[model samples]
Target chain A: SQTIHQWPATLVQPVGSPLSLECTVEGTSNPNLYWYRQAAGRGLQLLFYSVGIGQISSEVPQNLSASRPQDRQFILSSKKLLLSDSGFYLCAWRTSGNTGELFFGEGSRLTVL
Target chain B: AQSVAQPEDQVNVAEGNPLTVKCTYSVSGNPYLFWYVQYPNRGLQFLLKYITGDNLVKGSYGFEAEFNKSQTSFHLKKPSALVSDSALYFCAVRDPRNKLSFGAGTTVTVRA
Candidate 1:
């Protein structure tokens, strides 16, 4: 079975701090990866998606950026975090197929003080 | 512009009764609809999806959704509700590039 792993399950940083959240997929290759952020009482907002290594499509313009360094590794980074960046960060992957549901990781809760 | 609308902010039903969470979409091409459930503090879990062929698709946790192209809606349904089903439900539509556009989500409170 495939599994998605995200690290630093919870994080707290002051405004203007650097941010880095990692996500990795297991038991699958050549998958499409995505990054989403969910604020309190709000639906998820798509941040970025990667079709392959070095190929990323950004949906929302914000303080965050994402990278697919490997087939199964995706990273979300920020040079200077803002208080608005505080939210539940989620990473997802789907099989390289026409019809595939997104599989999500446990998610990281980031709190910017 | 592709989008999904989950009309209701919440739905309430008693245990063992029928339940529904409405969803509608607007897309140019064929609509790929999906339903996902999320518990508090947990990641979203895929419930069901309608890709092609069948209008009625069954998925995990005894949940199902009916696709109506004419109405441009894909509403999720279940015969008997469980108290454990009380959680947040989301309806999503796949865009032209297979990207998902989700609604604001609906909270289902299945009272015991």
Candidate 2:
């Protein structure tokens, strides 16, 4: 059985503060990792995806950046956060190769004030 | 580019009556469809997926979906509705570009 874990279930930070959200997966290796954000009354937006270590594909231009430091460890970071950066952040992992479904982690809710 | 469309913003159903939440999709290759449910303040839960053979895919919580190639639709259905079934339902398609293009979710309200 595989499970995804994200930290800082809820966060409150001042504007322009640095941000870091971590996601790790257990029971799977070489899984494709993704980061998605959901705003209020909006659909999930793909932010970044990593197919392998040191290789990441960013889908949107934003203040956020993602890194795959280890095979199963992904991190979303921002040097300076803005009010627009506030939202629910989700991390997901899918099997390598051609797979449709993505197993998501319990999201991290960030409130920028 | 593959994409999904959930036409309804909300669906109201009476308990014990059949319910259908509509979905339509567009993909380049064979469409791999999926249904997910999100409870309030919770992550999306996987319901079902259509990959290869069967058109009628059954999933958790007594939910099922039918894949239609000609109509380009995959509608989620259940024989009877329950109060606990009320939640936000999302329709998705595999972009195969390693992304799941999801629809703006539909909120289903099961009236007791």
Give the runs in model 2 whose Cα sits over 4 Å from its true position.
none
In candidate 1, stretches whose alpha carbon ends up further than 4 angstroms from where it belongs are none
Across residues A60-105, which tens digit of lDDT does each residue of candidate 2 receive?
A: 9999999999999999999999999999998989989855699889
lDDT tens readout by residue for model 2, B47-110 = 9999989899999999999999999999999999999999999999887576898899999999
Proportion of true contacts reproduced by candidate 1 = 0.57
TM-score of chain B of each: 0.97, 0.98
TM-score of each: 0.97, 0.97
Two-chain complex of model 1, DockQ on C-alpha atoms against the true structure = 0.72
Backbone clashes in candidate 2 total 0
Error of 1 at A24 (Å): 0.2
Q: In model 2 chain B, which range of ten residues has the least summed lDDT?
A: B93-102
lDDT of 1 by residue, B18-63 (tens): 9999999999888888899989888899999998998999999999
lDDT tens readout by residue for model 1, A9-89: 999999999999999999988999999999995599999999999999999878899999899999999999999999999
